[model samples]
Target: MEINLKNIFIAFLKISTILLGGGYVIIPIAQSELVEKRNWVTKEEILDYYSIAQCLGGIIAVNMAILIGCKLKGTKGALTSVLGMSLPPFLIIVLIANLIEKIVQIPNIDSFFWGVNLAVVILIYLAVKEVFLYALKDILSVFWFVLILVLACLKVNPVVLILSSLAFGLILARFKKEVKDE
Candidate 1:
């Protein structure tokens, strides 16, 4: 299907509307919608965009929308994607801000939040599983994954982890090319 501005906007708007928890929860939904259903993007493409998005400053979901939008259309697509991705959340936050205190006082609200938290955890697990499987495609990748996981657990800065991973990947690629040419 030819993805146009309207489709881009609507897709992101829908994603943003039901998006609870954080950016990690977005992975499976985006994969299903854009990759499986719409056929607008590939699994690898979404994963690549998502990885890059995480390394950047802003919200990961919005970063994803911008990257995918730019890929599909261009500057206008990026703007439209941002508007779609942000509008619902902004309005919802505004509405919730006023009523959050009272809303929490209601009976069963605690249970509701508890359930939502559990669901978010499951979603996060699914997202992590997907990315982990995608990333560990080789022995070298597996080595890097374990090393990085250890570094992350030890509280190493994410920027250092990312840069070092990039450097490692480049050197590995260069070595592979030189070996292949021999």
Candidate 2:
């Protein structure tokens, strides 16, 4: 049951390479590998890491790599994991940059990318649903969701919406406590 640094790096490398979509697609794979398969962390802990990553100003995959690496192997682990996760994508993008314009110009290649884009959209939607399921378990969460949806549809800044939701949650929690005391 001992997890080593090399294994951790390989796990992240595999995820980074095989994940077809962008950062969000990492969620399910991470949940499965870290929480379910490897038992390196719990579901709640994974969600917490995800939330922290989202709040921070960087890519979720890199943030997650650091989080998981630190959790398993300390600072060195975090560094290696981040490097392992980032290097492949960086190199791939660089290698593809020259060919991308021509590649997209091809009808069959365009069609393939379009299909892949659609699949990525679906994957992102499923990931959002899974993440929300962890938090939206009560009436308050539903109310907050409705509020956020309304605000988002109206083109409000997401930062404002998030802050407003936090304030609303605090107020609701206080009200719930007061009602219980009465």
Candidate 3:
């Protein structure tokens, strides 16, 4: 199948419809669909896109879709992807807004949401596991991993953590290069 704007839109639209629990949940589903099933992108590319998406401002799935779409077909692909990703949630929110009062009154809804939350937790765990395995390739990475986990537990803001990690990673890379040259 050709990787065109229409396909990109449809893929994201289908993904957005089934996606729950936001960005973390997108990982496995996207990997299965875009990488394994469609062959539109690679696993490594998805991982890289996911990592970059985390640093960006908007939603993770949408950011990822844009990056992949742009890589595949440029600006039109990106626009199409965003439209696909956004449309479902927009409509769902509008529908919910109209029925929220009645929806809240349903006794079984609490149970339903609780089950969904549990599933989301599992999805998040899977996403973290995939990223963790990809990231911790060496002793230095492990060191940074521990350090970052500590900082996160200490309640440091995520933006600060990411920025500091970027700075330190650059410095370490430069230092490694200089040492190798010697």
Instruction: Give candidate 2's error at residue 179 in angstroms.
Output: 15
Which ranges in model 3 have alpha carbons more than 4 Å from their true place? 178-182
Supply the global lDDT for candidate 2.
0.77
> CA shift at 70, candidate 3, in angstroms?
0.7
Best-fitting candidate, measured by TM-score?
Answer: 3
lDDT of 3 by residue, 1-182 (tens): 58988899888998888797556778888877788778998766788898789888977788998998899899999999999989999998988998889988898988888898799888777767766766777777799889989999999998899888778868988777642210
TM-score of each: 0.85, 0.78, 0.87
> Could you tell me which 10 consecutive residues in candidate 3 have the lowest summed lDDT?
173-182
Expressed as tens digits, the lDDT of each residue in 20-107 for candidate 1 is 7667777888887788888988777888898889878877888999998999899999999899999998898888998988988999
Clashes of each: 0, 0, 0
Superposition error at 160 for model 2 (Å):
2.6
Query: Cα miss at 108, model 3 (Å)?
Result: 1.1
Clashing pairs in 1: none
